[model samples]
Target: MLDRGTTSDDDDPPLQKWLARRGKMSALSLAELESCKNYTFQLGRGPQRCSDVPSGLTNSATLLKAEKNSPTKEGLLASAFFASPGDGKGKVRFLTFLHQLGDKKAVVKWDTAVTRGMLYIQLPEDPLHECSRDSLVELLDVAEEFSSRAIVFFSKKRNDMKQLVRTFKFIGFDILPPSCDWIPTSQEYFFMSYEFG
Candidate 1:
């Protein structure tokens, strides 16, 4: 766990800035951290499968399938998988978080091919609030380790877009242009990215 003591500096890391923005005086602690490539389907079809399973973002079909079957909403398990190119050649990475009681907390998907990682999904139950600031900072640190940039897409239908955008900006993510060739563009979603040194 990283320490968040009450200290001020001219060069505080983004995590410190975010923690200060949250206005919490108490130190934040993270739950146990875990990482793996294997994920057992919540529906329990069989043994744990590697993150390289077919249900990845390799193609439109697999991307849709992965979205349709995503377990992020259930909060049952923190699972992640990498989407490689169709030729089955690409780097893969994943991260998972477990609570002190051993319950799953969050899952983050990372893609190294583009040198940009996406926060594919997080726990629907606001794991960030439940787990506190350290967890989010830890995720960012992992993302920085994996790629030069990190991105997340937000649905236009969300009513809290203003607040969400503000919070993201406060933590160092920049709102990207409305159009992006890498993703299926629509009027429904906006993108944001955080650059790492």
Candidate 2:
């Protein structure tokens, strides 16, 4: 029989223990995002550069120009730049997970407002890759503590749309109706949201 440790620290709640056994998720600073060599998002067009702004995700001209020109003031000028309405009341954070060996596994751009939140996943180059379920759950757990709901948007034309939809639904997100007034109407994309009680 397996020996379950008896120490109080070892007796972490089921969710905490499960999360601890998987991997660590933490916020990534802007400098870290810029330094991450493995960061890439495969948009059907091709693998986009790390500095490229995710389509339909931001309207910040500063972020756009910063991402376009390398070694520019992107780090300084865009550090505090708010990209979405969500940023008006709160801050934007980049979260990532690293494996036991410190290899980056996933990255998420998170924007939080007083009551609303959003997530933008940076897809890996590997077509078969997906963020680990544990990591996503941990992210949701964190989001739940702050926002009443979390939202995600996906382009209809994405190659992984089917898989992404399934994954989000598996994690408790529901497809938002086309008439949902919380999000801006866009013909090119669909939205999903997870409401916390």
Candidate 3:
């Protein structure tokens, strides 16, 4: 019935207990974003080298750049960049575009929410004062193209767990449980997640 911490279902192999336990286990640390202003332009993209950035989401950039040739910094559609603050509530710069990931079809919209844990995504309100419908559709299409299977998380305030769950559900993404942890740091933490296909 059980293996280690995992339980076996009638149709599935013996459940790996550790997997079951850790499956929903979340770790939170107060991470302040480092700035991208200093990032170098590689083939027209900022911070061209993934190794230069911190671990975690930076690795995803490798795939991002590979899929779309370097876009002008000013021309970048959507992105989440590190904030300059070293501690206490860092900021992330998220830019939106017509068709961000280079896909020519399908429109995708952007939404933001926060989880109780430290992980977080930063999403500001619409920046463009007057964008053309074609421009907006193009941005949405690009979002759909780049975010084939990716998920994003945001935090507006601290310890709003219920808000997090509601946001997750609103976005139609699956929620794993009990993985949230609060680790204090010099700066405030933000919850973030991205699912890659």
Candidate 4:
């Protein structure tokens, strides 16, 4: 298990905003909250079929299916898949998670493609809270949804990487060597993909 002492971080803009905004939430009830900051779904092949399948992105068809299946959802919609290299070769993986920002909700589709030397992992704006145990589980669910053979995470900032790695490790993910060069970054970013056992 990971040590979740406090949701406090100096480099986290969400945490910073959390500290600056809102009143005491001690009396706040999660029961009143209709949705979660991070919500997950299963699409395409799950981790169990990773070896027999591949990795890709969550397509519109799947999103439409989800919309039709459930009519009353308003939060980050995560669609995961296993995709082969953009060239029909190489390897790719996928998973998704959500971050609370405000009352506003949006659907973020990670239509990322891994190229010879580049991997595009696009996400929505920053989150509104620190990564907690619940959020970590959501992340794993998303990973398994993609049927990823292995999970990977990347962050420009070492601190963010440390925090992310801690959370993932607590949830049973291990660090793997980089398959490609990770660009040096001043801002924080995270990329994690898990392999199916």
Candidate 5:
């Protein structure tokens, strides 16, 4: 594990100050956050698979099938795959947890996808007490409803990488280098595909 005691030459700006006006903290600044001793996800590939499999984002058809078969109300709505909260139109949306590489703690979002495998915009975690462990359980419950397998978290932050290495030892995923346009500040971003052994 990385040491938290190292002091930087100067006190870096608070994360809030560096975030985009809409609320996204700079993905590049994860390294700075690491200096503060907080744990966050790293960018990189996940575990490996038995046979070769594509590492890119899962398609809409697959996502829809996953949603329809999901056991939980939340998961059935495809909230786990989207980046925005609640379905537009005010209906309760899905909850998502994003582990930005090099930052501490995962960010929870209410989100939607712009494309099949990409998010349009990821909303910030709710400051109110609504998003506690119980909320996470509720979110997973929906996913469990349809998904036959465990939901895997993919991260690029070093800490997240460690967590993945620790938690998913039995599974296989591929950690691939990100594509050209996806410039993440972390050393690498990870791609996790669910694997069952």
Candidate 6:
């Protein structure tokens, strides 16, 4: 049997559950992409690192990760500096987890959901301090070990909960209107998970 697409039934559920915890979702909806300017205007009206950008999806194929411990910021998102699905809605899910003061810290959750015929590895978690160079190397190694797979990073910095909400809403997720307790700086909160890439 030819194994098509990224394989990781073990990791996706926990990741999905973690994402669900971060945001409130009720069914799926598609976005109404009115115009190019309009789309670009609301791309990322949230946190700014002065370097983060979106990386549009290209079949979810091979993804490249930036150097560890390096001050440089590049290749961070599928279409942005965060780890999220770029454009469209359909099956998109919003991760709206809130981070507590101390207990809520960043974590990594990577799994491959590749094309129907090929393989690709996606790091669907926070790239915080926990993800050391060695850990990332190990993750890449795991991907290489699979021969047909490529490991990718979904950084938390550019892909905070707020970004998720906005991105999801843009893609037509059943996101509730932004409230004070859930808006403004709420994106800065930590929605830490126990898992690591």
Runs with alpha carbons beyond 4 Å of true place in candidate 5: 1-93, 96-141, 144-155, 171-188, 195-197
Model 4 C-alpha lDDT per residue in residues 1-197, reported as the tens digit of each score? 22111212212232222212211222333332112122123223223335655324322112111111222221121222222324333332222333332233433333232222222334334431443444334443433323233334344445455666676677665554444233212234455544444
Per-residue alpha-carbon lDDT of model 5 for 1-197, expressed as tens digits? 22111222222232223211112222434343323321222122334343386534221111111121213333213343232224321111232333222233543443322221122222222332333333333333332222222323333444445654544444343343445222122333344333122
lDDT of 5 at 65: 10
In terms of lDDT, the poorest run of 10 residues in model 6 is 34-43
- All candidates' TM-scores? 0.43, 0.43, 0.25, 0.35, 0.24, 0.23
Query: Per-residue CA lDDT of candidate 3, range 58-107, in tens?
Result: 11111111111223432112322322234333322233222223343443
lDDT per residue for candidate 1 within 1-197, as digits (tens), equals: 22211222222243223223222222322110112222221111122246456432211100111111323322212212234224232223233332221134443332221212333323232323444334445556644533446665556656667876787788897877756533334466666777667
Error of 6 at 66 (Å): 31
TM-score, predicted candidate 6 vs. hidden true structure: 0.23
Comparison by TM-score, 3 against 5, better one: 3
Query: What is the lDDT, from 0 to 100, of the residue 113 in candidate 6?
Result: 30
Runs with alpha carbons beyond 4 Å of true place in candidate 4: 1-128, 131-133, 142-146, 179-193
Error of 3 at 88 (Å): 25
Task: List model 2 lDDT by residue over 52-109, tens digit each.
Answer: 6754321111121112122222211123332322443222333333321113544333
Ranking by lDDT: 2, 1, 4, 5, 6, 3
- Candidate 1 overall Cα lDDT vs. reference? 0.37
Cα-based lDDT for every prediction: 0.37, 0.41, 0.27, 0.32, 0.29, 0.28
Instruction: Give the range of the ten consecutive residues with the poorest summed lDDT in model 5.
Output: 59-68
Error of 4 at 178 (Å): 2.9
